[model samples]
Target chain A: MEVKGFWHWVRHTLRLFALYGKMDTLGLMRSMGMLLTMMLSDTVLNIAAVMGMLLLAERFGGIGNWSKYQVLFLLGYGGLVDGIINVFFGYNVAFISRRLGRGQFDHTLIQPQPIVVSLLTEGFNPAFGLPSLLPGTVLLGIALPHLVLPQIAGWWFLFAINMVASVAVVLAFQFAFGSLAFRAPRATEEISSSTMHLLMQLKSFPLDGLGAVLTGSLLTAVPVGGVAWLPCRALLGMGGGVTSYWLTPLLSMVLALVAVVTFWKGLQYYGRVGSQRYSNFGHRN
Target chain B: MAVMSAAGFMGDNALFLIDYLLRFLRVILFFALWRLILHGKGAINGYTLSTTLTYTLISEVFREVMECRTWLESGFWDGSVSMRYLRPMSVFAQYAAEWSGGVAFRLLTFSIPLLLLSSLMGVNPLPASPQAGILFLASLLLAVFVGLGIEYLFSGLAIAFRTHPWIFNRMRAAIGEILSGALLPFAFMPLGLGKIFSYLPFAGQASTPLSIYVGQADSPRLMALQLFWGVVLWLIAGRLWEKNKEKVVAYGG
Candidate 1:
């Protein structure tokens, strides 16, 4: 039954994309331009960030115990997760709050499909996400040989599964933040954006020296450390042992479950608000 | 008094508080990162961890002061800008006045608190001398004007490219993030690249004033360069606004 539901969503999403592609010429052009600009800027910024990290590392005689290749691997892992998120869920997640504010969310609510599925499919743009994959793939290729692969059949299996789990962790964050629209419709955009910005900044830096409390929060509650850091650690065999290697995927699953529950509860609250005729128009009430 | 009693001001304050909180958190995070990076090391590229923290705090405030909040793009897209042409004040002057009001508010509510907090935390440096303090103030004023001039130029370009004003906005943001030295200090970059960035108008936005405050840059020379760019950009923005203002008017109509 779950598999059937998944296929049903895929079919509907593909149809929506087709409709959008057929109709939105000017919007497509503008989005393409924006995507190109973003891609170029993102690549340049990534290079600069890596260089800055390298320079700092050089000044300190290298980041304590982590090589340049390991840092690059972390960066590549981050980029790959971001690229996948952008491709599948980035736009819809980013704009969900705006849609809720504008009352366009009502259209989704009225649809006979799941709200999450509808929200994810509404503004899916494959082209915008394609360029990000290039840099991510390039960086990953450069960092691959430096990684300590497991001496098992298909050692890439762990890395690939961890990458997917990392995507789930990030999506869970987006879902949790995007759910704020159900309560504070007006402030949702600001809340989501600021939250994402903070998380991105935290994730970009090395997590080793953030101490126990922050490291714990990033691994469990926030799960930002799980997004790239832990996965990179697992792949590099720097994770403490078998138990620690499995902890990242376990924590990601738990976060994903929490995100789903949060969204579901938020949807219920939204339904109650709507039935009570509580108009959050322009955030006045 | 009635307006003050109204709910709008409360709502505005609430929004401003949220923005303030986010920025405050960012400052704290960056301070922590600086601590981690330094780790008993004295300085990297001549910047002590304290000075780097000071630079980050000040740059964040300046960024808030210079932010125009997409008013130009929104005005062009929504046709509200046409109302400005009918008024006696020029469009650039109107925007400048509007932005100045916000800047004043931010200075009082945002910049002052941040300055106080950084000083309390012992991250911010006292000006090298009373003369340096005065020079820093003058350089800051010049920097703000230079930022305003660049904003006008970008706004004019947005009007000219009405269908894709976002591209201009994005480019401006990227340039500001990189060349303006808001993220990483330009001094940390290679010497030749740092020199080139320092000469650019964008550097006037944050690096020039902060550099002077930290005593890395000569106040007189940097302030002179900022003044030169300010005048040059002001003229170019005026010309561009004159040429493109009608195009947006027609497009909106």
Candidate 2:
């Protein structure tokens, strides 16, 4: 019964996405332009960041015991996770707060499907995500050979699993942050944006030196480190033991569970308070 | 204006505090990374660890002032430009005033305290000389003007391409950060490459001012270049605004 319901939601979401795609006459051209622009800018930025890291790496010869190529692998892994998140959740996530704030969320609540499912499919734009994923895949390809990992087939399997776990970690963040709209809808957008920026910066660097508290937070609560650092470390056969290899996937699962529960509670809260006020743009009194 | 100033002040200080906390964490993280890279070496690329740390902290401090998207992007997208058009003042002037107010409040509430905290922690670097200090102030004013001009061009582009103002916003941020040397010091690059980047208008924003403070570049020449770009970019921005204003008017906005 549950499997059937899930399939039904997936079919409904795809139909809605196809309908929207058909309605936009300029969608193809605009999407192409956006994809090209994003790819170019993203590539340049990634190259620059790698160059900066390389310069520092040359000076110091790598962070702790990790070599430059190993760090590059980590950077590539970060890009992969970032690409996946942007492709899947980027567009709809931006509107979630505004919809919740303006009483527009009521529309989604009235849908036959779950609110989370509806929100996820609201503005699913694959074009935006595909271009971003290209660079990540390229970077990963370049760095994979240099990494002293297991056999290629085994490493690829681990990488695939890690990537899926990373997606779960990222989705947990999106859902947790998006739930802020239920309370302070007016401020959630800025708060969400700033939090993401902070997380992005943290994930890009090696956090091993920040002592245990932060290192622990990034591993457990925030899990930005779980997406890239820990997974990369595990893949490289550095630091963590056999049991530690399972830590990120485990953490990812737990965080996703927390995200679902938190968002459910937020929905309950919204039903109680958010329905009482119709706070449209400029109409919030 | 008063309400805007108050709101801007409260909002920025609150957000600034949160951002500042994150920045402090970054500072600590980078400090350790640099230490590992330096490996007890005094400097890399002629920048001592202290000087480089100072540059990072100072740049983070002035980031908001160097940022110009608050008004232009928001006003154009939300149809608030129509309201601004109904007023007597030019839209640019209005934005400039609002930006300046926000910057002033930020400097008071955010930059000063952070500078004090950093200095107390012995990470902040003082100006090399009184001449450097004087030049740094001049460069900051020019940086603000350069930022205004760049934002004016962005606003013009937003009006011209109404559908994807977010794309322009992202481009402005990414390009602006790279060219302006906010992401990493241009000095970290090779000398020839750094010299080339210095010639661009975006370098005048944060790079030129901070470089002047640290006595890295020739002060007179850098300030002169900043002044030149400030005038040139503003003129181009004015022209772009004139050409694109009709689009907004046509939309009955």
lDDT of each: 0.67, 0.69
- Give the per-residue lDDT digits (tens) of candidate 2, residues B1-253: 6248646545313433554555566666666665555456675556776777777777877888776545566665555778888899998888787877777776777678777887665575577688988888888989988888888777677667644455566767766776787766776664355668889988999899988787776888988988999898889878877887777632213
| Chain B TM, every candidate | 0.87, 0.88
Report chain A TM-scores, every model.
0.80, 0.81
Scored against the true structure, residue A119 in model 1 reaches a CA lDDT of 59
Q: List candidate 2 stretches off by more than 4 Å.
A: A1-7, A10-26, A30-64, A94-98, A275-285, B8-20, B119-122, B158-163, B190-192, B249-253
Model 1, span A188-208: residue lDDT tens: 545556656555555656677
Candidate closest to the true structure, highest lDDT: 2
How does the DockQ of candidate 1 come out? 0.27
DockQ scores of all models, one per candidate: 0.27, 0.34
User: Cα RMSD (Å) between model 1 and the true structure?
Assistant: 4.7
Clashing pairs in 1: none
